[model samples]
Target: MTKEEAPVLLEVRGLAAKAGSAQILKGIDFTVRAGEVHAIMGPNGSGKSTLSKVLAGHPAYEVTAGTARFDGQDLLAMAAEDRARAGFFLSFQYPVEVPGVANAQFLRLAYNSIQGARGRDELDPLEFDDYVREKMKLLEMAPAFLDRSLNTGFSGGEKKRNEILQMALLEPRLAFLDETDSGLDIDALRVVANGVNTLRNDDNAVVLVTHYQRLLNYIVPDYVHVMDGGRLVKTGGKELAIELEARGYDWIQKSAA
Candidate 1:
């Protein structure tokens, strides 16, 4: 397809999602194009995380209405693993710890699994190790980390870096970062942001979900969206985040109402 005819990377149209009987996302619509960064900001319980989970195909979330399209394909119809294999990646706010799986091994397994699904050859352990080492260097991660269990006993900053390392290796077409900067110190935040900035290219896009404007100071998203009460209420550019930081959510709530 020509660049103009190239499918949109991500499109959400009137999406409604729920957990059990309680609705968490109500008729949300947005789109992300190649080489763009979009930030979604909202107060607690505004359904930001629920949107990410629903896009990633979490079983606990039911899509009660509307549709999500990724690369011109039906996103909600795909299984969770299939979503990942189809070039969707999510960096969770709380990464899990697998005690027995060495970090390097886990990375290899994840990388190879995606490659296998795409009909690409899997990398051997040695090749994969070398590959990941290069990616870790971008994050300034130590060689010793490769031998440790995944996220086991890691510091908050370390866990965040580990998540970026996976993102770099996967080289996803679109990445969803859910509250990635929540617990990091200033220095750690810069490190993680640098890693994210480095990975951005014309072929990929990022959607960052955050509650604080501090993270936006570093990543500098091209567009900012405000969400409240399980719906997207407003959208603007980088300046919108500054406005919200200065005025807080009260003004946004009033305007939406």
Candidate 2:
């Protein structure tokens, strides 16, 4: 398909997921197109994170039914690593720390892995260093961060920024940011938002799973969806988020009830 005729980047039809015997997502349906930023906002335990994991093919959660298509390809059929190499990036809310791995080395390995999967020439350390340094500047991260162990002693904000750094490096076609602004301060929030803004292009889209409207203020979404009881209860533009913020979710809960 040409750029104009390219299918939706993401299309979920009656998607349901379960963790062990417990059902988390119940018949969720949504479609995201290129050049769009879609925000999924809801109260706690509303299956926001579950949706992200299921899309990225997390093994612990089983996709009980329904279908998810990414750029006209079957996403569920792809392996987790294959999904990443195929341009699916997930920014975890809680980034893990590696005790002895240097941040630079980890990034180089990830970049090279993606390149290898795409059948592109792998860059040596020297080549990758220059590429990653340019990305770090886009994130406003210091050069010193490259030498430190991955999130070993970094602050919460630092870890989130590091996640964005990975996103920038990977440059996925579709990015799922699960609660990226969870523990960020004002300054860090701005930095992270800026990085996301810079990455926004007509060729990619972002699915932002968030709880607060504050983050929306920074990276405005074209569509805002409210999920409840494992299903999407409402969808609208940025104003919907403001409305929900102004009038708590009680009305939506009552309406659903």
Candidate 3:
């Protein structure tokens, strides 16, 4: 058929989560097929980030109920690192800074770890340098970026670009980007969006979690899912994002009601 009709990469059903006593992600059901880009938008406290973290298998939240399958494997059963090795990636909303780790060193370690997990020989430092630099070119990052401590002293746009670089190098099958557009200017947004678009293919999928539709303008999604009251209230095409931009999320809650 078509790339748009590619097989499923992620299937999440009846997903419920809780952070200690607080209930979040009451019941999230979504499907991400290979070659599809899905955007999840909602207001604050709506559990968008929570769902991303839960799927990534973060220890802070417990999966009280439900199931997720990544390429036919039980996703919830895998550890966070295993999830990454299994081609599941989550880009944090707040990419943290590492004080002592060189960016190149960190990226190489992460890349090699995934390769080792997949039963492949790790790339030597010299080999990885050439490989990583090629991926950096996709984000227009400078060679000096590899020398700095990871994310330390990086501008907001720089950190986001660094995250995209990780996504590019690892080449995960499914990626969940949380608020990647936050704190980015128009030009940076376009660059980051273009980098993500370049990585799109019939074997991977992207789920973007954001609060604004501005990013959607750069990276158009095949589906837009509205989140409210800890669940998905609506699903539509790219036009849904424009509608939310014009009318705000209240319009979705009202429409869902």
Candidate 4:
């Protein structure tokens, strides 16, 4: 059986959301099962990012209406921390830079925090370093990066690779990478996509929110869903992504209607 035939990990029905007074998502609907790599594609300001934020449980975007459940539990009912502990991960488009926090230290704290929440043993700094370094090797990142401040004085590719490193360590059941391809050159894009592809499995699901089809070339998606006018307008296989690349999103709006 395919990912669709597998158990559903996420279910969004009639999802409506807003940023302050301006409404964004309008009755959006979709379902993602375990083992699926779903690509959410659309034009700028088409509520693509908004949908990812809403699903990630961002405080700035309010869920005005609708229901979303993850692993049969209520998603909106859980706190952000709870969501993370429950195996939800979101890699930001623009990974933040911290001047004082070392990458290793930050990752350790985050890892241990989630471990504590899950009633698992927290790794010591030395143990975590060993574990994290092994994971970093998958992304072809150097050990020197661990000593630096988080994303500080790093290239765009380094920042994105760091995000994927965190995802590898967390091993989230549902991972949503928002605009991960933004500002990346071909080399960086391939490296980041390789990391993402490595993490995908038959038991976990990934949702990649991207604008361009170039990223899809490196990481083929099991499903492509188009977002326009604050709602999911179309769903198809990877072919839809290739078509979107050839014809552009303007062709989707008519099909969206």
Candidate 5:
């Protein structure tokens, strides 16, 4: 079967979400099939991040209407942790710093938890150390990263790289990276993009939420979607990003209006 014929990994229809009585997503209808890379680009506060968070079962957002199904399971019904265990991942734009937790401890626990959920054998620290270190190398991460506290005292690029490292280890079936390209220098961006590109396969899909077209240059999304006013206004192939980059969102927003 071709990539277009791959199984649907995520399906959303009429999805609306609100945070503290402020309605954010008006109506979102999206679908991602296995093996496709999709990008969501929009202005600030266009609900791009909210859409990812809501789909990932963030507690702050309440689903007021519609449905989201992932891998034939009801995604909204799953808890945040359950969603993660179910092979759904959301890489936050601003990864939180865990002051006391060592990166190795955190990654291993997350990896083993998902492994056990999938009825796979859980790796012990030593075994996991070997496995994870190999995965870290894909992101050009040093061994010292395992010893540092998670996201603590790390540069912006380092934090982003760490996020991609977590992604590599988890190997989620559907990953929604929210503005992962933010705050990274060119070299760092290239590394992160390489890691993401290497992880892509016929069985997994990625949805990137970003503001700049620069990220698209490296990732090369199969589909480029323009989100405006909490809804996806337009969608096209990779060339659409180049057009949006040059023409700006004003015309798109106005046209959508």
Candidate 6:
């Protein structure tokens, strides 16, 4: 089926949000259908990241107006953990470092929690070990990573890979990845991008929040959106990203003016 024919995974209309007293998202309308990759691109403080945080039900942001429906249900009304249980996943740009938790333990608990919520059988430690290791291989991550503290002392690349590994294990229906390409070397970028690509299928969708077109070269988004002044100003095909790279965002600002 074509993208337009696919089922709508997320729909937003007049989405306005704020962090504390500052309004971020301003009257945004967006949609995502299954089997598509969408890239939200903009300069610093354009609300690209804020959009994802709001959809994921982050506590810091308040939805002042508009509606967000995920899989035909009220998204803003659901709790953050409930959003995850309903197949909504958001990868943080900065993966937090949990000092005492082993990476494997963290992954297993998260996987089992979601599984139980879905009424699927929860895997025990041994069962989950085998399952997660297979997922880790997709990211080319070493087994040693499972034993280390979650994101603690991990290099930038390792942390990103760990985040993707979580995505692989949970297999979210809709993933909102925030600045996933930041601070990665070339090799790491390819590995992480490859992992994301491998996880893609006609049954799911990915929404990427990024600043540069370089990530698009690997992920190949079906649609590219440019945001400015807390609103989505323009949207085009993958080639729009190429234009942004060459000409800069100045024209976008002028055109929207």
Candidate 4 similarity to native, TM-score: 0.96
Candidate 5 clash pair list? none
Clash counts for the predictions, in order: 0, 0, 0, 0, 0, 0
Q: Give the TM-score of candidate 6.
A: 0.99
Best model per lDDT: 6
Poorest stretch of ten by lDDT in candidate 6: 155-164
Question: Candidate 2: TM-score?
Answer: 0.96
TM-score of model number 3: 0.97
Task: Score candidate 1 by lDDT.
Answer: 0.93
* Stretches > 4 Å off in candidate 5: none
- Please give the lDDT score for candidate 4: 0.90
Per-residue accuracy of model 1 over 131-217 as CA lDDT, tens digit each: 889999999999999999999999988998999999999989999999999889999899899999999988889999999899999
Expressed as tens digits, the lDDT of each residue in 1-257 for candidate 6 is 78899999999999999999999999999999999999999999999989999999999999999999999999999999999999999988999999999999999999998999999999989999999999989999999999999999998888889999999988899999999999899999999999999999998999999999999999999999999999999999999999999999999999999
For model 3, give the 10-residue run with minimal summed lDDT: 1-10
Q: Rank order by TM-score, top first? A: 6, 5, 3, 4, 1, 2
Q: Estimate each model's TM-score.
A: 0.96, 0.96, 0.97, 0.96, 0.98, 0.99
lDDT of each: 0.93, 0.92, 0.93, 0.90, 0.94, 0.94
Candidate 6: lDDT of 163? 90
lDDT computed for candidate 2: 0.92
Please write out the lDDT profile of model 4 over residues 1-257, one tens digit for every residue: 75558999999999999999999999988888999889999999999888877888889988889999999999998888888889999998888899999999999999998889889999999999899999998988999999999999988878888999999999899999999888788888888888889899888999999998889888888899999999889999999999999999988898667
**What is the Cα-based TM-score of model 5?**
0.98
Clashes of 6: 0
User: How do the residues 7-67 of candidate 5 rate in per-residue lDDT, one tens digit apiece?
Assistant: 9999999999999989999999989999999999999999999999999888999999999
